[model samples]
Target: MSADALTFDCIVVGSGHAGSCAALAARDSGCERVLIVEKSPPEWVGGNGYFTAGAHRTVHGGLQDLLPIVKNVTPEIAANIDLAPYTADEFTRDVMRLGDGRSHPDVVKALVDGSRDAVQWLAERVHVPFIFSFNRQAYLVNGRQVFWGGLALSVEGGGKGMIAADRAALAAAGVETWFSTAAIELVIDGDRVVGLQVSREGESITLRSRAVILACGGFEASKDLRAQYLGPDWQRAKVRGTPYNTGDGLALAQRIGARLTGDFAGCHSTCWDANAPDDRGDRVLSNQFTKSGYPLGLMLNAKGERFVDEGEDFRNYTYAKFGREIMSQPGGFAFQVWDSTTIPWLRKEEYADDVVERIWGDTIEELAAKLVEKGLEDKDAFVQTIRKYNEAVRAFQAERPEAEWDPAVKDGVSTQSSHLQLSLPKSNWALPVEQSPFLAVKVTCGITFTFGGLAIDPDTAGVLSDATGKPIPGLFCTGELVGGLFYRNYPGGSGLTGGTVFGRKAGREAAKLSGAAR
Candidate 1:
């Protein structure tokens, strides 16, 4: 290769949330030339960030504490916004509790400490609107303040509009973007990364750089990797987002001796269709049944028996209900049955007409017949189960006021009802499968992202090699590529929070390295 083949101050791989932030931060920090290499086209900008519900949380005092230290936010604006402050201790406790003590303390601390600034930086600098409320769930500001609607807008333009805004900012900053270019490997010179070998339009080229950032995302969409790392159960589950994430970056990094951490793979189980086609051609509505607190009139496994507390944590419940726990039974999965009353509620409140349509029946027998027609269940058995459940619901309602009856009668944390008035009629039970046209849909767990990835230092955002227990020089990894930070469980909106905070850190640090080289 010629000496002038290609060169840049910094090279960032991938154009997801992390890579976008990294590129922007580097340029803003005065790096003269930064290049972003993306295997996919620009139409795929923001990666999963475009599909997110955009809530951000931090463990530190809200925007107030961060405004003074962060360059992006002004004291006047910070003071004007209603700020919610959460102590580091409380944040730590919540994270640890949610993670089941498996997450790295340092990573959690870095995310929590830097979160306020990250949120402010994106809002103030990128022109992304940040609200305090949306759809009833409060935004956990600074890990303390429960603000409404303070999340990035879904690409559909739900609210927080940072995904598009950030992309625009990166372009305005003159960050060179090479789409349809895949980074095949890290160009290593001794222990340091020199740059990347890229393939674009069938041409292989080498790009030289002083610093490199890996933000290529995780392996949730790769069936082979999911089966290998996440176990057989994952192989059979449905996937929620983009199907292109095959863990190419993670595999490449490992080949170069990067250590992996967190679990082999962790997934959210709730709101997934247990038997929805793996091709994901069918639109599965999760918000309706999972987030809207809908009642499960009857939950039956393949053998037609109730197996779990329907109202438990939707993510966890889905996993347990779909995995070997329920699949090992006579039926490979479970079917959720509800009535006409439930369908309208799901449609009006949950915006889940898709789900309602899939399972709707005008009569209990018709619904059971439909499932049989779809090859989703045994017609006779499903009908019998509905009859039994209806009898039980009627008995329960006869004894107690409709308002007093809980759909998730057995529950540790009862999410049985969000709109309490809706649960008052015993007939409102996702029960009485008697309401002629019953609804039944075979459901399975669907995963959003895999948690396992390269281990990194929270302070530097540097990818650490297992052999040396130290960061690999010139190589910084962020987003889903870096793991052991989230533990096995997620803390509400922490996924996006970590990505933004660490992406900024990596970009800034990479810029500093580039400056030194010059």
Candidate 2:
């Protein structure tokens, strides 16, 4: 790298939610010249953020507090809804428990503490219009929509709109972004990062900058990396996001000896449509590839046996891990079986015809025969499993006539097997697949992002040196590259918000060092 290379105050890699936030925050923090380098063309510059449905898990002070941010909530709507506070303590506890205490406490604390303000902070800079998540976060009760879980609002029009908002803000802020430019290496000299080496349209270029924020993504899209870090057969897993997220930032950071953290093999996997393409689906038809109605049904492996306790917890907490369990099954797939009783109330994502593969039958034998025709399993085994499950549900129904079946919260509805021979038992909200028009939707394991990356100072979002565990000058990281915020598992909708929290922090802190020119 030459000493006379062109320099800027700050350079942000990638154009996803994190990168967009970082670039904006740097400019806001008084960085005179800010640049964002994205490997993808401008059309696909948003990375995985564009593929998401804009669900954000933030600690809120109930519906009353949410009225200001959520622009579409009418007075009538607010009056009919019931919501409670989601304090920082509750958010922190969930983060700790969500990862089984494997998550770094400092990072989790930052995420929880910065969450509520972070959403507002990003929205003000990007003009993101927030709206209530009526489909997945709410259930109809007494002619009113009641929101559950810790999630409340999402960016209007989902992730695509979010990207558009950020793009406009970037233009308004006079920030420059270079498309089709891939950062290959960090320009390190005497333990100080000075610039970046990038290849733009196959032409090499050296650009010097006081700070670099690496926020591209993780290794979920790389077959070789997935096999190496996540073990064998992981390459067969479907990608739920952008194919361009092939760990460019993680590789660049590792080249500089950034200390890695979090569970390397862990990821945010989910039950996705088995017939979906290997890469992500169309941005216009996003959220169609994810099928999340498993809580209302039974998931059987290839051998026609239930493999997990679907009702062990709410879908928000359990779906992230169940997808990984499905990959561990006999054929790397699972079938979500339901009946007419539970089908009508199923999540709207299940009805996306282009992305989902569904089967139906009026009788258990007919359903099993249909599955056998697909080369799945023997008809006898499927019938026996269904019969045993039906018996248990009926027994429970007879014993507990007062049980209230609620979907928003964990209702006490469950099954009771008198035989006690069932290998996998449903813990809560269990209903038998005995009604006419039995339905089954096939789904495979789909990974979102890996939970491993370099460790960073949670306060400043600076990448820590592996040799001394000290902050590396001019090296900051956000998005998926800053690990220890997530570990074995994660809560749904936290990924994007986590990126916002650290991205803004990284941009501000990185900009603070921009005054120290070489």
Q: Give the number of the best model, judged by TM-score.
A: 2
lDDT of 2 by residue, 1-518 (tens): 45543688889998989888998888998888888999888878788888787888899888887788877788988888877788988888777888888889899988888888888886676788788888878888788887777777787878888888888999999999899898999998889998999998888998898799998999998989999999898989998888888989888988888888888889988998888788665666666678888888898888888888888887888778888999999889988888999889887665644556678888878888788755567678778887888888778777778887787777767775454435667888888788899988888998888999989999999999899899899999888888888877887788888989999998898778986322
lDDT (C-alpha, whole model) for all candidates: 0.63, 0.84
What lDDT does candidate 2 reach at residue 19?
Answer: 89
Candidate 1 local distance difference test against the native: 0.63
Shift in Å, residue 274, candidate 2: 0.9
Cα lDDT of candidate 2 equals 0.84
Q: How many residue pairs clash in each candidate?
A: 28, 0
By lDDT, who's the top model here? 2
RMSD of each: 7.0, 2.2
Per-candidate TM-scores read: 0.77, 0.96
- lDDT score at residue 251, model 1, on the 0-100 scale: 77
lDDT of each residue in 438-495, candidate 1, tens digit only: 6666665556677788888788898898899899888888887778876556656666
